[model samples]
Target: MHEGEGEIHADWVLAGRALQDVWILPGIFHGTTLRIPDAARHGWHIFWSDPLHHYYGRQLGRAVGPDIVQIGRDDTGQATRWSFSDRMPDSFTWRGETADDEAGPWQLVAEFHCRRAPA
Candidate 1:
């Protein structure tokens, strides 16, 4: 990621593991999965930091970001649980489901309120 004063970037490989503590300055962003000989199976999600409390660094009580989740998977690899948070805005949202198959439709799993602890 780059802040635009000068170009700086870093690359990471997500191999179906949850990532935490990925902090970077907001800037242009792009993602791609290449199929050299065949496609690979992987899962990925990003929970941004609470910019207002950047120093807290995702601390349980002081940090927050758009919270997205997925539950059971269908045969076609669609999420049986899909939800988005409007409380905390995010630059972008992504769900792994694609349009290649029409066998399954995304289903909402649950609804709940989120609150941050006093800073």
Candidate 2:
């Protein structure tokens, strides 16, 4: 697998109730994601599309802990999770995992220990 660096720009929209993220992978893939909270369900509805890869999907994200948000999609029997941890003022860890089913023996797909870019 190829390992490389990318940048993400996030913004709060819908009167700060929703989050939108734009990812730049520089010739690999670029995508935009929107996350809107579903208070009744205690989770967020996630929508993303990456035209370069011809990929798009929807997922549900729920906070697993104070610093970790896990998102999963169950429609295809291929669930994916993204966990955030080790947060600091200028850095954090993001891990990606996947499983054949929602009841997972998850396999790690990627892990990024990210730091703030120099201003």
Candidate 3:
């Protein structure tokens, strides 16, 4: 991860048919995300929790195009959208947005351009 002049690290591991994402920002933050695919719905169910901030999130993810996947959650009238795009074997881009409602002009909250570490 990249923010201003600092760096964050992430690890992705496969577990059965699901994937787990572990994120670390040194002492500042740490979080885990689990993604499970729903084949019947052609989408994925995503769960995230950050104990450091006492935060948790649930979202549904679906592919919108060949290289774009969007995950969104609508809870208590608040909605959030996180999208991954520009995917390649070694790189991708992620964006986060929020909206008041489902049919919304989403407001950008964060963006990250990422590259995979070489083996």
Candidate 4:
């Protein structure tokens, strides 16, 4: 993977009330390595590099396609679910939300990475 940066928004809530809304304006990645500049403030394990890239890549048997990773955490800062989906050389769409009750179920956010096909 190439070097990149992105944003992260974490909502810390309890009993349906938002306690904190933390935003990491810039998340960094270099050569498939990921780092969260404000991880300490946002809470532990709020974000990280895809640890299952090799496993999923092996399962798919090829590297050219869209790979998706989904993560869900509850209000108590516990991971409730984690999953991934991939598509090969075509348009695709995803629906639904996170399964964790403490984490509000809302539409998932997706990031797409595409490069030009060779001639």
TM-scores for every predicted model? 0.25, 0.85, 0.79, 0.24
Candidate 3: segments with Cα more than 4 A from true spot: 1-15, 74-77
Error of 4 at 84 (Å): 5.2
Residues 1-119 of candidate 3: C-alpha lDDT, one tens digit per residue: 34642244544557477778776666556877788889998898888777898767788889887555555664344677888889888887878777886577888887877777667
Stretches off by above 4 angstroms in model 4 are 1-47, 50-86, 89-104, 113-119
Off by over 4 Å in 1: 1-79, 87-103
Summarize candidate 1's per-residue lDDT along 29-60 as a digit string, tens digits: 22222111112323333333334443111101
Ranking by TM-score: 2, 3, 1, 4
**At residue 62, what lDDT does model 1 achieve?**
16
Candidate 3: which pairs clash? Answer: none
For model 1 the TM-score comes to 0.25
| Global lDDT of each candidate | 0.31, 0.80, 0.73, 0.33
What value of lDDT does candidate 2 attain over all alpha carbons? Answer: 0.80
What's the count of clashing pairs in each model shown?
A: 0, 0, 0, 0
- Residue-level lDDT tens digits of model 2 in 31-109: 8889998999888898877878776767888877667666676345478887778989999998878888767888898
Reference-based lDDT, residue 25, model 4: 23
Residue lDDT tens for model 4, 39-93: 3443222233343332111111111234343344533444333332444454323
